[model samples]
Target: MSLAIDFYDETNTITEEQLNMLLELVNHAAIEEGVDAGSELSIMFVDNDRITEINREYRGKDQATDVISFALDDEEEGEVPLNLGEEVPHLLGEIVISVQKITEQSLEYAHSFDRELGFLTVHGFLHLLGYDHMTEEDEVEMFGKQKVYLEQYGLTR
Candidate 1:
C-alpha cells in the first residue's frame, strides 16, 4: 500500500530521528489497520498557542489539546460519493499535534517523550480511521486498540 504522509513541523523543535520514527509508526499503523493503498494524510506539529487557537476555533475549547484529527472521509455512507473506477489518492485528512503538550504529558505521565509522541500519533491515526471514544464502550475499545498498537510498536510507558 502506498500511504503518502505530509509532515509539517511548525515548532521546528522535533529532531530528524523523531520525525522519521513517527513516519514509520504511521506506516505501521496504516498497514495494521488495513488502510487503502492510495491513502494520503498529513501530520502537523505545532506549539501550545497554535493548538489552543485550533482547539478554540474548531472544537470550541479554548485550551491546548494533545492532538486533534480532521478526517476527510468522515461523512456518512450516503453523504459522499464513491470513487468509481478511477485511480486516485484517498485523502485521510490531517493530525495536528502539540509539541509542547508532548513534553508536558510525557513528564506528567512518567513516560519517555518518544512513548507519548507515539501514543498521540497512533491515537490521531485511529481517529482518522473513524475511531472515537465518545461512550464508555467506545472508550474501552479505542483505548484498548491504542495500548495494543503502542505496545506492539514498542512504545511502552
Candidate 2:
C-alpha cells in the first residue's frame, strides 16, 4: 500500500528514523487490517499544552492525553475500498500525540522513548482503523492487537 504520512511537531525531539519507524508500524497494522492501497494518514506531535487543549475541545476532557485519533471512515460500513472519487488521495484521518507524555511515560515505564512512541503511534493508528476499548472484552481485544502490532515491529519493552 502507498501511504502518505505527515509528522508535525513544535519541537524536533523525534528523529527522522523514529518517524520512519512509526510510519512502517502504522502501515504494517493497516495491511494486517486489510486496508487497500493508496491509504493515507497523518500524525502530529505536540507538547502537553497543545494536546491538552485538543483533548478538552474534542473529547471534553481537561487533561493532556498521550494520543488521539480521528477516523474518516465508519467501520460498520464494511470493508469498502477507499475511493478518493478524484485525483485526491483518500484521507484516513489524523492522529495527534503528545511528545511530552511520551517522554514522561517512557521514564515511568522504564522503557526507551522509541518504544513508548511506537506504542502510542500504533495505538492511535488502531483507533483510526475503528478499534476501541469501551468495554472489558473490547479493551482486551484492542490492547491485544496493539501488543501484537508493536511486537511485530520489534518495539517490545
Candidate 3:
C-alpha cells in the first residue's frame, strides 16, 4: 500500500532530490495521520505570481501566501465530485506551494530551505485531512503534528 502522489513543478527553485524528499515527507504525513496508504494527493509548485492568483480567485485574498490546500473529501460542502464507484481512487486533495515564499520565509525564519519546505508540505497535507489553525487549540494540534513529521524526517531547524 502506497500513496499515489502527483507532483507538478511550475518553478525550478528546487531540484529533483528535493522533490523526492517532499514525496517521502507527504507519504509519512499520511501514514502518521492514519490515512490509508492507497490514498492519493496532488502537489503543485508555483511562483509567487501564480500563487497570488490562486489565492485571489479561491480565498478572496490578494496576497501571495505560502501554501494553499484544497480538500476534496468534503461531501457536506459539495466539494467532492461523484465518481464512477469503487474503482475510482481516493483523492485526498490538492496543495499548491509557492517557491518564492519558501525561500523568503526560510531566510526570515533562519531555517534551512528544506526545513521550511517540509513544514509547508506537512501543513498543507494536514489541511487535506481536516486539520486547521483557525483556533489556538487547533493551531497547537496541527502545528505539533507538523513538527513531529518534520523532526522524524530530519527537517528540524
Candidate 4:
C-alpha cells in the first residue's frame, strides 16, 4: 500500500529538494483524495519546446502549457476494469510539466518558483483523478481544491 511515482527530468533543471517536496505534497494529496494506496503515476519535466510539441501533437495546441496530464484509467463511473485478479498498482497517468513555463509563470505571478511548481503539480494530479475545469462550476471546484492542497502543503503565495 504505497504511492509509486516515476520522475523524469528532461530539462535537467529540477533540484533534488524540489523533487522530494513535490513527492511529499503528492502523497499527502493522494491520501486526502482517498486514492488507492497501490497507485502509480509519472511526472516528467521538460523544456518549453518539448512541451509545446507535446501539446500540439496530443492536445492540438501549438503553445507551451504549464502542465498537461494523461490519465490511463479515466473510465467513467461503473465502467469495467482493465485488469483482472492480481492486485497491481493502478497506473493513474503521466504529468508533463514545462520547466520554462514554471519559471516564467513564477515571475509573471510574482510568486516563488516552489509555489508555482507545487500548484502545477497538484493541478495535473487532480486531472489524473478525473477533475476537470472546463465549466465555470467545475473550474471553481477544481481550482478551489488546488488552493486548499497548496496551502496545506505550505506552498502558498
TM-score of 2: 0.90
The residue-by-residue lDDT of candidate 4 on 23-80, one tens digit each, is 9999989988999987999999999999999999999999999999999976888998
Task: Provide TM-scores for the models.
Answer: 0.94, 0.90, 0.93, 0.95
Off by over 4 Å in 3: 77-85
Please write out the lDDT profile of model 3 over residues 24-82, one tens digit for every residue: 88888777878986889999999999999999999999999999999988778656667
Q: Which of the two candidates, 1 or 2, achieves a greater lDDT against the reference?
A: 1
The best-first sequence of candidates by lDDT reads: 4, 1, 3, 2
Expressed as tens digits, the lDDT of each residue in 67-125 for candidate 2 is 99999776565676757577777678999999999999999999999999999998898
lDDT (0 to 1) per candidate: 0.91, 0.88, 0.90, 0.93
Give me the overall lDDT of model 1.
0.91
Tell me the lDDT of model 3 at 97: 97
- Put down candidate 1 lDDT per residue, 58-124, tens digits, no spaces: 9999999999999998777668577666677889999999999999999999999999999999999
User: Residue 57 error for model 2, in Å?
Assistant: 0.8
Question: Considering TM-score, where higher is better, how would the candidates rank from best to worst?
Answer: 4, 1, 3, 2
Model 4 residue 29 CA deviation (Å) reads: 0.8
Best-fitting candidate, scored by TM-score: 4
